[model samples]
Target: MRTNALSTLSFWNTPRIGVARMQSDMAQANQEIVTGRYADVGLALGSRTGLAVGLRQKSAELAALRDSNNAASLRLGTSQAVLKQIQDGADATLTALTGVPEDKRAGVLKDMAANRLGTLTALLNTSAGGQYVFGGTRTAAAPMSTYATSPASPAKTAVDAAFRAAFGLSQDSAGVSAITEGDMAAFLDGPAFQGLFAEASWGTTWSAAGTAPLTNQISLSETVETSASANAPALRKLAMAYVMASELGSANLSAAAQGVLTTRVAGLLGEASKGLITLQADLGRSQAAIAAANTRLESQASLLDAQIMDMEGVDRAEAKTRVDRLSTQVQISYALTAQLRQLSLVNYL
Candidate 1:
């Protein structure tokens, strides 16, 4: 008469809670794998990549500026080297004028003239990577007109005429006057010559003379004056020395004047040699600055590359491991949930 009362039982549902928790854990792992981040998208730790990216962009900009600065510094260094060579040649000319015998003076003068012409050509046609360095942005045209080997020949006359036409100067007007001692010092020490030496232009012109011989290119301006009673120190000295050399070669000057000319030439050479020492120092400093700029640019580029890598580079192994773990966790959660749902009192009996 005892009957077994089987009460309707609720299905075991604890697996549902385990399934939900497993799904949440799997989703979090999947998110980390997809985003390659260990923190939430908008969290503080997640901002590191963005900050690195910004820093990298800024570094790239600085690197570009530094590259431009390096290029400019290199041009300046090249220019300084050219100037130093010119100065050395000038010193050599002074030495030749002062001490060489009268019989040999003409040959030395010719050599000096050739050397000076070479210097002028080098200055005007200065190039870096095949682009003109001193053309002041005019890369197509030669800075100095082609030199004529013979100053008195027809070819020389034509070349001179063409040069004058390009520069808007008349043949007769293109001449440099003899400089006095005071004028010479002033030109060497004054702003006008200083500006010229610095490679600055006088308005639109690259040089002051056109279609004129090198001897006719007086560097000093006309506004400068000298007393009639006293000889202009620098100008007269140069003129007297040049005249004496020419006269000696032509056998026109007295022996006493020739001797004086020789001594004067020596003194000029000594002074020029001293000047070269100063110029070389300047060139050295300019070269050092260029090297420093180049070094800085290279260092900045390296730093920028590192910063960029930090921003976007990925760890492939870690990412793959996270994805595999998430997949396994999801599978395990589904299996457990199914097993829990299957558990029933009737099945147990």
Candidate 2:
């Protein structure tokens, strides 16, 4: 190694090097004391660094699953709540129609069915974290189109066409009073019934749909079907009932005619109520699975936390001791450096 010829320059370099080393050591000790983890992370882990890395990765994986589980749980809960609302709505309409005078049944029944249809549409279009629950991978858009003049609302158009085809006139035709249950049943079972339900005319109103339901992986090799499609049978039944009740509202039907319509609609709503039971149960299963996954992930996270602590954590008492020792050493090094600076050839003389 080449040497500096001047002794003063050499003396200056030595003290600076000593002070720098002491400062580095002191900083490391201070960091360990403040952080509760070894300052020399890489060196401390050494050959075990890979294990610690794997443990941390596992922790992160569990955390990700927990976050997904939280969102999924809420989504499942929302679905269940909506199902209850539908069931209760159907029940209320049925009870009201049964108790009302036959002469006043049409208006009361129409309002109830119309309300049910709108509520169900809103529920089906609900999204979890911005993803539509019933859209079957078409998360960006609502699952149902409104029953209006819009071309996309084939369900509404079909229902209107159905009324014309069945009565040979508008739904408000006074001749509607002459109709029978057979006529209502025919319409209910016919292709014209598609107009009131997006699921019935899925491609037009509820586009990007499929039979395969939405899902999420709850655990390794365990996945859950998260939500049912908009075309669920129960929904279809409700839509049919709602459409009939709504379109029949303006019809100047007689007492017998009102009884036939309301009675048929009440029966259909009852069936829809029954069908929703299965859907609610299915959604509950998904919610339960998410809860179970959350529990397992929490246990796994605790273990990972322990592993990480063993790999990197420092005892607080030990760390404080180390910081105190390094601080004393640093003070001694400063004193020695100052003493050495005074020992030049001229100072010796």
Candidate 3:
């Protein structure tokens, strides 16, 4: 009989514990209903937490891929727009040069070449979001030198020398030539011309894709050539055209000189123009690759999301039912707790 006696404090404490437990369950069910997710995710999926964690990691990776794809898309878009502008400018300049009579072709329309030189160079030195678009991997600095022989561009020094060797005249030495079509073609097609135009001879390249095209990692296992290898064939050919117009126009020109220079340059312009169409398609392919990567990432993300939801998310209707049940039980517990508190020997008096 002595062992069976229970204290009032013990009785009150036992019911109080039950009340606290009910309130905690009520709060958890309410939270699950509001969030559409388990309040205790780890407890709810104790053995399956590994699967949930893996899915979350995959989702994070897909998100990163999306961010990279967006950046690549924007950069490629800017590059495409600027490239079109350069092509159009070249077309207009070539048209103007051709439209004029042969007599005034060189000196008369020289300004067009000069203007184009400035614009095309500006295009080559283009930047997007503080990164040099033409620099390939070397995005911090300009990919090509300025047209001047100043320290800003080392290529100009080599170019000037190459011109002197090819035409037997300095870039600035106002000397006219009967330099024939065959002569121009031979020189342009030779190693000397290659030396002048080749990106390798420029000593330093701003493009990270130096000697190769730029490569971008759009996904975990895949990479694509992003923009065209900095400073395209058309742009270089245009530069040569610009330099010839400005230099040759400065000197006296015979009919033969005009014919030869114009013919050779006209061919270069034509080829450059034709080449651009192909180049544009190549760039489009790179963009298409990025698009493909994004599509794959999106699909993967959907799968991972579903898996994660299965592990961590709650059923909305079921959570609501649980909340209602817990709410009633908590109310009953509160009433019991109150009744227990009211019980006292003095109440009987």
Candidate 4:
């Protein structure tokens, strides 16, 4: 019988082709599985890195916000402290002006001087983080310089001369000037006083004589008045009262003058006291605003972190599951490809 060569060829070639194709498909499937596994690992790593980066960024932002809040709070605290001192000084002056005997006026004046000096020192020498608070842009220097006279006279000629030159004002025998308590209160309310709290520059210069050498000026000192004649309003008023009290002693002043001076002193004190209250309120508000801003910034940073986590964080359990599935698929493909490679036409026949 004639051999069906074509049939044999068909049988051998067809199965061989099928097996080779299957092997190629299996190889591709195996490669795909490995690629998928590596992709999963890469994605997981990327997610982890992203999360870490986000957390670090948020931490830095929060720290900065906290620092800003702390700084604002410190400023508010200092302002409040200074305001309290001013209030106390004003109160002392008020007390001295009211119903104190002339003979006792000297002691009251001395006390007032002490209070003024103390407040001035406190204001001028105010500091934060080693920087002067009230020295304006010139933070390195004390706002009030030391001034003394020879023979220990009550007069402060050196201070008066400096004040006149710095502020263009003349002094009376007591080195006091005609500045009123009301004027002082107004001065504190002005931009110059605000600048002190804000750590900004003041516009002009002031003298111990309570005169502004420049058109606009802002400064403070303890020596409102001395034995030398300068026309400081607060000091002059105090001195006048002291003199009246001393001259009258047990004797009372003319009711009219007494009434006028008393009313004037009381009005000035009331105005100054009110200003303190207002400034304190402002400081409280500023502190609150800063705290609010800090809170907002922190919240925003946290939200950003959460968003970053969502974008980058890995699902560990899912990744493990995918790895396992890909591993099994690879094993199956390898086993099937090996089986196909072993198949032969002789075995089938």
Count of residue pairs whose backbone atoms collide, per candidate:
11, 3, 7, 30
Q: Please give the CA lDDT of all the candidate structures.
A: 0.46, 0.75, 0.72, 0.45
The list of candidate 4 runs beyond 4 A from truth reads 1-63, 102-107, 136-141, 146-267, 312-349
For model 1, what is the error of residue 307's alpha carbon versus the real structure, in angstroms, after optimal superposition? 4.0
The predicted structure with the larger lDDT, 1 or 4, is 1
Q: Between candidates 3 and 4, name the one with more favorable lDDT.
A: 3
Rank by lDDT, highest first: 2, 3, 1, 4
Q: Candidate 2's residue-wise lDDT over 141-205, tens digit each? A: 77776654445366666666768877787777777767776776576656666444544365565
Q: Write the per-residue lDDT of candidate 1 for residues 147-264, one digit (tens) a residue.
A: 3344443323433344244334432342212223343344334454233223233212223222211111011111111001001122123322332233222223234433444555
Worst ten-residue run, lDDT, model 1?
222-231
Query: TM-score order of candidates, best first?
Result: 2, 3, 1, 4
C-alpha lDDT (0 to 100) for residue 315 of candidate 1: 66
Candidate 3 lDDT over residue span 63-166, tens digit each: 98899788778778878887788778878878877888877787755677777777777777777877776777767777655564346355556656776777
Poorest lDDT segment (10 consecutive residues) of candidate 4: 213-222
- The number of the candidate with the highest TM-score is 2
TM-score-wise, the better of 1 and 4 is: 1
Superposed model 1: Cα runs more than 4 Å off: 1-50, 73-77, 102-107, 135-141, 147-277, 294-305, 319-349
